[model samples]
Target: MTTHPAPTVHDVRHEETGEGQPTTGLDAFAVCALSGAYSAVAEARRFTAAILEGWGVCAPVVSDAVLVVSELTGNALRHAAPRGPDAAESRPDLVCAAWLALAHQEAGVLCAVSDSSRAVPALAAPDLMAEEGRGLWIIDRLSESWGWTRPDHTGKTVWAQLPVPRPTR
Candidate 1:
Protein backbone atom coordinates (compact mmCIF):
# COMPACT_ATOMS: atom_id res chain seq x y z
CA MET A 1 0.00 0.00 0.00
CA THR A 2 1.20 3.53 -0.75
CA THR A 3 2.12 5.45 2.36
CA HIS A 4 0.47 8.77 3.13
CA PRO A 5 1.13 11.35 5.79
CA ALA A 6 -0.54 10.77 9.13
CA PRO A 7 -3.66 12.81 9.84
CA THR A 8 -3.08 16.18 11.49
CA VAL A 9 -5.68 18.46 13.06
CA HIS A 10 -5.39 22.22 12.56
CA ASP A 11 -7.34 24.80 14.52
CA VAL A 12 -7.96 28.10 12.74
CA ARG A 13 -8.39 30.33 15.75
CA HIS A 14 -5.04 31.97 16.55
CA GLU A 15 -5.59 34.24 19.53
CA GLU A 16 -5.48 32.39 22.82
CA THR A 17 -7.31 33.83 25.79
CA GLY A 18 -8.30 32.20 29.09
CA GLU A 19 -8.23 28.41 29.16
CA GLY A 20 -7.24 28.09 25.48
CA GLN A 21 -10.33 30.02 24.40
CA PRO A 22 -9.92 32.29 21.42
CA THR A 23 -10.44 35.92 22.28
CA THR A 24 -11.67 36.69 18.79
CA GLY A 25 -15.30 35.88 18.21
CA LEU A 26 -14.42 34.15 14.98
CA ASP A 27 -15.97 30.76 14.60
CA ALA A 28 -13.61 27.92 15.51
CA PHE A 29 -12.59 25.67 12.65
CA ALA A 30 -10.56 22.47 12.55
CA VAL A 31 -9.71 20.05 9.75
CA CYS A 32 -7.91 16.74 9.35
CA ALA A 33 -6.50 15.13 6.25
CA LEU A 34 -7.48 11.48 5.99
CA SER A 35 -6.12 8.69 3.90
CA GLY A 36 -8.37 6.30 2.01
CA ALA A 37 -7.70 3.57 4.54
CA TYR A 38 -10.55 2.34 6.69
CA SER A 39 -8.65 3.43 9.80
CA ALA A 40 -9.48 7.01 8.87
CA VAL A 41 -12.99 6.54 10.20
CA ALA A 42 -11.80 5.93 13.74
CA GLU A 43 -9.12 8.58 13.42
CA ALA A 44 -11.77 11.11 12.47
CA ARG A 45 -13.88 10.17 15.48
CA ARG A 46 -10.99 10.69 17.91
CA PHE A 47 -9.97 13.96 16.27
CA THR A 48 -13.52 15.31 16.45
CA ALA A 49 -13.97 14.33 20.07
CA ALA A 50 -10.74 16.04 21.08
CA ILE A 51 -11.58 19.22 19.22
CA LEU A 52 -15.11 19.42 20.62
CA GLU A 53 -13.84 18.76 24.12
CA GLY A 54 -11.25 21.51 23.77
CA TRP A 55 -14.02 23.87 22.69
CA GLY A 56 -15.91 23.02 25.93
CA VAL A 57 -18.86 21.42 24.11
CA CYS A 58 -21.11 19.31 26.25
CA ALA A 59 -20.50 15.57 26.40
CA PRO A 60 -23.74 14.69 24.64
CA VAL A 61 -23.07 17.03 21.75
CA VAL A 62 -19.50 15.78 21.52
CA SER A 63 -20.67 12.19 21.32
CA ASP A 64 -23.21 12.97 18.61
CA ALA A 65 -20.66 14.94 16.61
CA VAL A 66 -18.14 12.11 16.86
CA LEU A 67 -20.65 9.64 15.54
CA VAL A 68 -21.51 11.96 12.68
CA VAL A 69 -17.85 12.29 11.83
CA SER A 70 -17.42 8.53 11.80
CA GLU A 71 -20.32 8.04 9.41
CA LEU A 72 -19.21 10.77 7.02
CA THR A 73 -15.57 9.70 6.98
CA GLY A 74 -16.44 6.03 6.51
CA ASN A 75 -18.77 6.82 3.62
CA ALA A 76 -16.12 8.93 1.97
CA LEU A 77 -13.50 6.22 2.33
CA ARG A 78 -15.77 3.58 0.90
CA HIS A 79 -17.45 5.47 -1.94
CA ALA A 80 -15.07 8.20 -3.04
CA ALA A 81 -11.78 8.43 -4.91
CA PRO A 82 -8.91 10.84 -4.49
CA ARG A 83 -8.91 14.03 -6.56
CA GLY A 84 -6.86 13.77 -9.72
CA PRO A 85 -4.09 16.14 -10.54
CA ASP A 86 -2.91 17.37 -13.96
CA ALA A 87 -1.65 13.90 -14.77
CA ALA A 88 -3.54 10.83 -13.70
CA GLU A 89 -1.40 8.44 -11.68
CA SER A 90 -2.81 4.94 -11.79
CA ARG A 91 -1.06 2.49 -9.53
CA PRO A 92 -2.34 -0.61 -7.79
CA ASP A 93 -0.74 0.35 -4.49
CA LEU A 94 -1.65 4.02 -4.49
CA VAL A 95 -3.67 5.35 -1.60
CA CYS A 96 -6.40 7.98 -1.97
CA ALA A 97 -7.33 10.68 0.55
CA ALA A 98 -10.20 12.74 1.95
CA TRP A 99 -10.68 15.67 4.33
CA LEU A 100 -12.75 16.09 7.48
CA ALA A 101 -13.61 19.57 8.72
CA LEU A 102 -15.36 20.73 11.87
CA ALA A 103 -16.62 24.24 12.36
CA HIS A 104 -18.53 25.86 15.20
CA GLN A 105 -21.84 27.30 14.05
CA GLU A 106 -24.20 29.66 15.84
CA ALA A 107 -25.83 26.86 17.81
CA GLY A 108 -24.17 23.67 16.68
CA VAL A 109 -21.13 22.01 15.18
CA LEU A 110 -20.81 21.46 11.43
CA CYS A 111 -19.14 18.18 10.48
CA ALA A 112 -18.12 17.88 6.85
CA VAL A 113 -16.11 15.38 4.85
CA SER A 114 -14.85 16.14 1.38
CA ASP A 115 -14.10 13.42 -1.14
CA SER A 116 -13.53 13.21 -4.86
CA SER A 117 -16.78 11.46 -5.67
CA ARG A 118 -19.63 13.60 -6.93
CA ALA A 119 -22.32 11.03 -6.18
CA VAL A 120 -24.83 12.58 -3.81
CA PRO A 121 -25.75 10.77 -0.63
CA ALA A 122 -29.34 9.69 -0.24
CA LEU A 123 -31.27 8.87 2.91
CA ALA A 124 -32.59 5.40 2.26
CA ALA A 125 -35.84 4.11 3.63
CA PRO A 126 -35.43 2.01 6.74
CA ASP A 127 -34.69 -1.63 6.09
CA LEU A 128 -34.77 -3.38 9.42
CA MET A 129 -33.87 -6.73 7.93
CA ALA A 130 -30.83 -5.45 6.13
CA GLU A 131 -27.48 -5.42 7.85
CA GLU A 132 -25.97 -2.47 5.96
CA GLY A 133 -26.90 0.95 4.50
CA ARG A 134 -27.80 2.69 7.73
CA GLY A 135 -25.22 5.44 7.85
CA LEU A 136 -27.35 8.25 6.50
CA TRP A 137 -30.34 7.04 8.48
CA ILE A 138 -28.36 7.22 11.71
CA ILE A 139 -27.07 10.67 10.80
CA ASP A 140 -30.61 11.91 10.12
CA ARG A 141 -31.72 10.62 13.47
CA LEU A 142 -28.84 12.19 15.38
CA SER A 143 -28.21 15.50 13.63
CA GLU A 144 -30.38 18.60 13.26
CA SER A 145 -29.71 18.75 9.49
CA TRP A 146 -27.50 17.12 6.90
CA GLY A 147 -26.67 17.76 3.22
CA TRP A 148 -23.95 17.98 0.60
CA THR A 149 -22.23 20.79 -1.29
CA ARG A 150 -19.88 20.91 -4.24
CA PRO A 151 -17.62 23.93 -3.89
CA ASP A 152 -15.79 23.12 -7.14
CA HIS A 153 -15.20 20.36 -9.68
CA THR A 154 -12.68 18.56 -7.52
CA GLY A 155 -15.06 17.06 -4.99
CA LYS A 156 -18.13 17.41 -2.80
CA THR A 157 -18.50 17.95 0.93
CA VAL A 158 -21.10 15.92 2.78
CA TRP A 159 -22.01 17.72 5.98
CA ALA A 160 -24.17 17.42 9.07
CA GLN A 161 -25.02 19.93 11.78
CA LEU A 162 -25.47 18.64 15.34
CA PRO A 163 -27.08 21.03 17.80
CA VAL A 164 -24.96 21.84 20.86
CA PRO A 165 -26.91 22.82 23.95
CA ARG A 166 -25.42 25.74 25.82
CA PRO A 167 -24.33 25.14 29.38
CA THR A 168 -26.32 26.81 32.17
CA ARG A 169 -24.14 29.33 33.96
Candidate 2:
Protein backbone atom coordinates (compact mmCIF):
# COMPACT_ATOMS: atom_id res chain seq x y z
CA MET A 1 0.00 0.00 0.00
CA THR A 2 1.26 3.47 -0.83
CA THR A 3 1.24 5.84 2.15
CA HIS A 4 1.64 9.58 2.60
CA PRO A 5 3.66 11.31 5.30
CA ALA A 6 1.57 12.95 8.02
CA PRO A 7 1.66 16.71 8.30
CA THR A 8 3.91 17.92 11.09
CA VAL A 9 2.08 18.26 14.39
CA HIS A 10 2.67 21.55 16.11
CA ASP A 11 1.06 23.91 18.55
CA VAL A 12 -1.85 25.53 16.72
CA ARG A 13 -3.58 28.39 18.50
CA HIS A 14 -7.31 28.74 18.18
CA GLU A 15 -7.91 32.01 16.38
CA GLU A 16 -10.95 32.87 18.46
CA THR A 17 -9.32 32.14 21.82
CA GLY A 18 -6.05 33.94 21.10
CA GLU A 19 -4.29 31.41 23.36
CA GLY A 20 -1.18 29.48 22.24
CA GLN A 21 -2.74 26.11 22.90
CA PRO A 22 -2.38 23.00 20.79
CA THR A 23 -4.86 22.16 18.09
CA THR A 24 -7.14 19.15 18.61
CA GLY A 25 -9.64 17.11 16.61
CA LEU A 26 -9.86 17.71 12.86
CA ASP A 27 -7.49 20.62 13.04
CA ALA A 28 -4.61 18.22 13.83
CA PHE A 29 -4.85 15.09 11.72
CA ALA A 30 -2.94 12.29 10.01
CA VAL A 31 -3.91 10.59 6.78
CA CYS A 32 -2.88 7.45 4.92
CA ALA A 33 -3.65 6.55 1.33
CA LEU A 34 -4.45 2.88 0.94
CA SER A 35 -3.96 0.78 -2.15
CA GLY A 36 -6.64 -1.59 -3.40
CA ALA A 37 -4.98 -4.68 -1.93
CA TYR A 38 -6.62 -6.35 1.06
CA SER A 39 -3.43 -5.84 3.01
CA ALA A 40 -4.39 -2.20 3.21
CA VAL A 41 -6.63 -3.08 6.13
CA ALA A 42 -3.70 -4.24 8.22
CA GLU A 43 -1.65 -1.25 7.11
CA ALA A 44 -4.37 1.14 8.19
CA ARG A 45 -4.49 -0.45 11.63
CA ARG A 46 -0.76 -0.16 12.06
CA PHE A 47 -0.81 3.41 10.86
CA THR A 48 -3.56 4.30 13.27
CA ALA A 49 -1.77 2.74 16.23
CA ALA A 50 1.49 4.51 15.50
CA ILE A 51 -0.09 7.90 14.97
CA LEU A 52 -2.30 7.76 18.05
CA GLU A 53 0.55 6.56 20.21
CA GLY A 54 2.85 9.29 18.96
CA TRP A 55 0.20 11.83 19.74
CA GLY A 56 0.00 10.56 23.34
CA VAL A 57 -3.47 9.10 22.99
CA CYS A 58 -4.21 6.58 25.75
CA ALA A 59 -3.85 2.88 25.07
CA PRO A 60 -7.53 1.98 25.08
CA VAL A 61 -8.49 4.78 22.72
CA VAL A 62 -5.63 3.85 20.42
CA SER A 63 -6.84 0.25 20.34
CA ASP A 64 -10.36 1.25 19.49
CA ALA A 65 -9.18 3.67 16.83
CA VAL A 66 -7.08 0.96 15.20
CA LEU A 67 -9.95 -1.48 15.03
CA VAL A 68 -12.30 1.18 13.67
CA VAL A 69 -9.78 2.14 11.03
CA SER A 70 -9.30 -1.48 10.03
CA GLU A 71 -13.00 -2.19 9.66
CA LEU A 72 -13.68 1.02 7.74
CA THR A 73 -10.72 0.51 5.43
CA GLY A 74 -11.66 -3.11 4.84
CA ASN A 75 -15.25 -2.22 4.04
CA ALA A 76 -14.17 0.47 1.63
CA LEU A 77 -11.79 -1.88 -0.15
CA ARG A 78 -14.35 -4.66 -0.44
CA HIS A 79 -17.42 -2.63 -1.39
CA ALA A 80 -16.39 0.69 -2.92
CA ALA A 81 -14.92 1.69 -6.27
CA PRO A 82 -12.36 4.29 -7.18
CA ARG A 83 -13.67 7.63 -8.47
CA GLY A 84 -13.33 7.95 -12.21
CA PRO A 85 -15.04 7.27 -15.51
CA ASP A 86 -13.11 4.01 -15.59
CA ALA A 87 -13.99 3.06 -12.04
CA ALA A 88 -16.13 0.11 -13.06
CA GLU A 89 -13.56 -1.20 -15.47
CA SER A 90 -11.39 -3.89 -13.95
CA ARG A 91 -7.71 -3.30 -14.57
CA PRO A 92 -5.55 -6.01 -12.99
CA ASP A 93 -2.47 -3.86 -13.33
CA LEU A 94 -3.97 -0.87 -11.57
CA VAL A 95 -4.95 -0.84 -7.92
CA CYS A 96 -7.74 1.33 -6.48
CA ALA A 97 -6.88 3.75 -3.68
CA ALA A 98 -8.72 4.75 -0.50
CA TRP A 99 -7.89 7.26 2.22
CA LEU A 100 -7.81 7.03 6.03
CA ALA A 101 -7.68 10.06 8.28
CA LEU A 102 -7.22 10.24 12.08
CA ALA A 103 -7.54 13.36 14.13
CA HIS A 104 -6.82 13.91 17.82
CA GLN A 105 -9.64 15.62 19.69
CA GLU A 106 -9.42 17.11 23.17
CA ALA A 107 -11.37 14.19 24.62
CA GLY A 108 -11.19 11.63 21.84
CA VAL A 109 -9.78 10.67 18.47
CA LEU A 110 -11.73 10.97 15.25
CA CYS A 111 -11.24 8.34 12.57
CA ALA A 112 -12.49 8.61 9.02
CA VAL A 113 -12.18 6.54 5.88
CA SER A 114 -12.84 7.99 2.44
CA ASP A 115 -13.60 5.91 -0.61
CA SER A 116 -14.66 6.64 -4.17
CA SER A 117 -18.12 5.12 -3.95
CA ARG A 118 -21.20 7.24 -3.33
CA ALA A 119 -23.00 4.36 -1.58
CA VAL A 120 -23.62 4.93 2.11
CA PRO A 121 -22.59 2.27 4.58
CA ALA A 122 -25.49 0.54 6.26
CA LEU A 123 -25.88 -1.96 9.07
CA ALA A 124 -26.85 -5.44 7.96
CA ALA A 125 -28.95 -7.78 10.03
CA PRO A 126 -27.01 -10.96 9.59
CA ASP A 127 -27.68 -14.27 11.29
CA LEU A 128 -26.18 -14.77 14.71
CA MET A 129 -23.69 -17.32 13.38
CA ALA A 130 -22.77 -15.33 10.30
CA GLU A 131 -19.16 -14.35 9.96
CA GLU A 132 -19.85 -11.38 7.74
CA GLY A 133 -21.85 -8.13 8.05
CA ARG A 134 -20.77 -7.24 11.58
CA GLY A 135 -18.42 -4.35 10.87
CA LEU A 136 -20.80 -1.51 11.47
CA TRP A 137 -22.24 -3.12 14.57
CA ILE A 138 -18.81 -3.49 16.07
CA ILE A 139 -18.04 0.13 15.21
CA ASP A 140 -21.20 1.34 16.88
CA ARG A 141 -20.44 -0.58 20.06
CA LEU A 142 -16.89 0.68 20.28
CA SER A 143 -17.22 4.29 19.18
CA GLU A 144 -18.76 7.18 21.09
CA SER A 145 -20.44 8.14 17.82
CA TRP A 146 -20.11 7.28 14.17
CA GLY A 147 -21.53 8.44 10.84
CA TRP A 148 -20.75 9.28 7.22
CA THR A 149 -20.64 12.23 4.85
CA ARG A 150 -20.57 12.74 1.09
CA PRO A 151 -18.12 15.43 0.13
CA ASP A 152 -19.38 15.94 -3.42
CA HIS A 153 -20.76 13.10 -5.55
CA THR A 154 -17.53 11.30 -6.23
CA GLY A 155 -17.05 9.79 -2.74
CA LYS A 156 -18.17 9.19 0.81
CA THR A 157 -16.37 9.26 4.13
CA VAL A 158 -17.40 7.27 7.19
CA TRP A 159 -16.22 8.66 10.50
CA ALA A 160 -16.11 7.58 14.16
CA GLN A 161 -15.11 9.31 17.36
CA LEU A 162 -13.55 7.30 20.20
CA PRO A 163 -13.48 8.89 23.61
CA VAL A 164 -10.23 9.29 25.51
CA PRO A 165 -9.39 10.32 29.03
CA ARG A 166 -7.66 13.63 29.49
CA PRO A 167 -3.96 13.36 30.20
CA THR A 168 -2.55 14.34 33.55
CA ARG A 169 -0.09 16.77 31.99
Best by TM-score: 2
Model 1, position 73: C-alpha lDDT score: 90
Write model 2 residue lDDT over 1-169, tens digit each, in one string: 1112222223234444357654333546898889877889999999999999998888888888888898899899888845446755744333457889988877688898887776777776656798778888888889888887744455677888788886668
Please provide the root mean square deviation of candidate 2 (C-alpha atoms, Å). Answer: 7.6
Whole-structure CA lDDT of model 1: 0.77
**lDDT of each candidate versus the true structure:** 0.77, 0.76
- The CA lDDT at 87 in model 1 is 18
**Residue lDDT tens for model 1, 10-93:** 323467877987664437999898986678888999999999999888899999999889989988987775444621364333
Model 1 misplacement above 4 A: 1-26, 82-88, 91-96
Best by lDDT: 1
Listed per model in order, the count of residue pairs whose N, CA or C atoms clash below 3 Å is 0, 1
